[model samples]
Target: MDKKDLRIVFMGTPDFAVASLRVLVENNYNVVGVITMPDKPSGRGHKIQHSAVKQYALEQNLPILQPEKLKNENFIEELKTLRADLQIVVAFRMLPEVIWDMPRLGTFNLHASLLPQYRGAAPINWAIINGEKETGATTFFLTHEIDTGKIIAQERIPIGESDNVGKIHDELMNMGAKLVQKTVDLLLEDKVDAIPQEQFFNNEADLKSAPKIFKETCRIDWNKPVEQIYNHIRGLSPYPVAWTELYTIGEEPIAAKIYSANKIQTEGQLPVGSISTDNKTYLQIACMGGAIEVKEIQLPGKKAMKIDELLRGYKFQEGSYFK
Candidate 1:
């Protein structure tokens, strides 16, 4: 079958998913329709906002469906009208079996990690937090369990020593887009040789999960080793960001978000979370075995700033520390 004749129904929500959808549309693939989340209010104004996928679908003049419930009978009837030969999901919500099983060519998902590792909602973030030197993207068939389906194809990439989640997220987004197209071509030619998830791992215990990150998950524990603290900060950088409470000698604890930091090895022992600053250029927090020299930070109601810029106007109290 020619690529232009295959009727595809694409599903996705965020910017990460846009790359793949854009590739299919730009390459003249027959994307018959798009399904995205319902429009919702956002920001202080409470203005309703369309999802990234919805906005892009509008621009391309593609048919769209925003179902409040995937299993709604009306929605299912509408989806069936699209007459999709295949379905593609990227960074979208899980679908009911009825929806995934409806298409003739079956549904496939573009996941950010190389399965069967990091199988969950936040794979890119967890890989960096765990200090892994390598990670990648995968395309797989959808099944009953989340992210447990047979893999169609995978592409690997190295994680740089100082790479943050935001950096890795973009790299995989583009790479995953190409992989999606490749998977589609394989499907078109009837040449796909999918492998089960179990074939990649020796035991189930060796698998690592990438559960959804919460506010508490981004909290920095000062008692851990400097390397760990450093990784934690970078892994969540530019997003939910690692945070701590700054306690001065007699002042109330102030909350601060740490965006960038570097590990500093030292000799003498200091109280965990102890603050060391020159009152002009640098701010360092003591942790196990060393200190973390904060490079970028943000206080409540303030824009993110470099350490020197923050220190120039605000001074840390003599006995200030973080907890």
Candidate 2:
């Protein structure tokens, strides 16, 4: 079949998914329709916001469907009308069997992490939090279980010591986009080799999971080693930031979100969560093996600022510490 003649329906919602969809459209692939999250209210004004996919689809003048319920009879009928030979999902919601099985060529998904590992909602975040030296993207056929399908192709990338979720996300997003196009072409050419995820898992229990991160998960634990604490802060930096409670001797605890920090080896022993600051230029918190020099942070109701700027206005008196 001609690449452009194979009918395809794309499903995604976030900016991460946009890269892949853009590639397909730019390559003149037959993306007959796009399915994204329903428009919903957001922010202080509660204004309705279209998903990133929907916004891009509008720019490309592609047909869109936003079904409140995936299994709605009306939605199913409309989906069938597209008569898609293949379906591609990226950074999208879980699919029902009816929806995934409808296409003649079946559905494939682009996942942020290698299959059989980091196989859940927040793979990118978990990988960085775990202090992984490497991570990658994978394209696989869809089945009953989530992210457990047969692998079609994968592209690996290095995760530097300072790389955060944002950096890794962008890297994987572009790599995944290319893999999506590659997978589609393989389908058209009948050259794909689908390898079961089990082939790589000698011990399933040893595999790392990428469950969704929660508010409590982002809380800083100053009792941990410097390397662990550093990873915890950077892994969630710039979004759902790692937070701690800053309290003076008798003042109420203040929420402090740490965005950037570096480890400093201390000569003398210090209690965990103890704060050592000049109240002018630096703020360091003692941990298991060393202290972390906080560079950027945000206090409650205040904009994120450098340590110098925060020191100018805020004071952490002697005996103040983070809990």
Candidate 3:
């Protein structure tokens, strides 16, 4: 079958998914339709905001469906009308069996981590938080269980020592885009050789899950090792950032979000969460074995700023610490 003749229905919602959809559309693959989340109110104004996928789909003049409920009979009927030969999912919510099984060639998803590991909603973040030196992307056919399907293709990339979630995210986004295109071509030519997830690991206990991160998940535990704390901060950096409560001798605890920090090996002993600073150019938080020198941070109702800039205007009380 020619590339232009294959009818593809693309499903995604965030910026991560846009790269794959854009690659397909720009390369002239037949994207028959796009399915994204419904527009909803955002920000203080409560103005309706279209998802990133929806915005791009509009720019390309592609057909779009923003269903409130995927299993609604009306929505299913509408989806069936698309006559999709295949469907591609990226950074989207889980679909019902009816929806995933609707297409002829079946649905495939672009997962951020190398499969059989980090299988869940937030793979990229968890991989970094666990201090893995390597991670990658995977394309797999959808199945009954989430992220348990047979893999179609896998691409590996190294995680740099200082790479944050935002950096790794963009890298995988572009790499996954090419992988999507490659998967489509392989499927079109009937040359795909998919492998089951079970083949990659022996014991189920060896597998690590990337469960959805919550507000509490981003909280920094100052008692942990400095290396662990550093990884935690970078893993959630630039969004849903790792945070802590700054405590002074006789005032309310102030909440602060840490965006960037470096682990420091020191000989000076201090209790975990103790504050160490020059009150002008640096702010360091003591942890097990060492400390973390905060590089970028944000306070409530204030923009993110470098440590020096923040310290210039804001004074850390003499006995201030973090918890």
User: Taking the tens digit of each residue's C-alpha lDDT, what string does model 1 give over 9-61?
Assistant: 99999999999999999999999999999999999999999999999999999
Error of 2 at 70 (Å): 0.7
Model 3: runs farther than 4 Å from truth?
Answer: none
Q: Tens digits of per-residue lDDT for model 2 on 22-119?
A: 99999999999999999999999999999999999999999999999999999999999999999999999999999999998999999999778999
RMSD of 3: 0.7
Choose 1 or 2, whichever is better by TM-score: 1
For all predictions, the C-alpha RMSD in Å is 0.8, 1.0, 0.7
Query: Each candidate: what lDDT?
Result: 0.95, 0.93, 0.95
| Residue range with the least summed lDDT across 10 consecutive positions in model 1 | 246-255
lDDT of 3 at 169: 95
lDDT of 3 by residue, 249-299 (tens): 889898999999999987776999998899899998999989999999998
- Per-candidate TM-scores read 0.99, 0.98, 0.99
